[model samples]
Target: MKMLRIISYAGLVAVAIMLLVAMCAILEDSVISHRAHRQELTGSTLSSPGLDHFS
Candidate 1:
């Protein structure tokens, strides 16, 4: 009985760790994509004809 209980606790802990790692990876990817999108928007606006008139 004790061995079974230990195994159950270990499995739960392993699952928790895996979930935490997955969440971190997802968050990192989201942040990188957001930064890239912002850069893309800025690049487009900078190339607009109106901005060229200012130069």
Candidate 2:
């Protein structure tokens, strides 16, 4: 019984870690897309970096 409980806890922890990682990945993607959109709106170009720094 003790072994089964430990196994279940371990499985839950693994799932929690997976979900955390997936959330981070999704957040990063949205942030990147947002930055790209902002750059387009502001006409910021690669030749001059940090133009969006003020924004």
Reference-based lDDT, each prediction: 0.76, 0.81
List candidate 2 stretches off by more than 4 Å: 46-55
Cα displacement (Å) at residue 52, model 2 = 5.8
Query: In candidate 1, what are the lDDT values of residues 1-55, reduced to their tens digit?
Result: 9999999999999999999999999988987776567658787533445544322
**Which window of 10 residues has the lowest lDDT sum in candidate 2?**
46-55
Candidate 1 lDDT trough over 10 residues, lowest sum = 46-55
| Clash pairs detected, candidate 1 | none
| Candidate 2 residue-wise lDDT at 31 | 77
Q: List the RMSD of every prediction in angstroms.
A: 9.3, 3.3
TM-score of each: 0.77, 0.80
TM-score of 1: 0.77
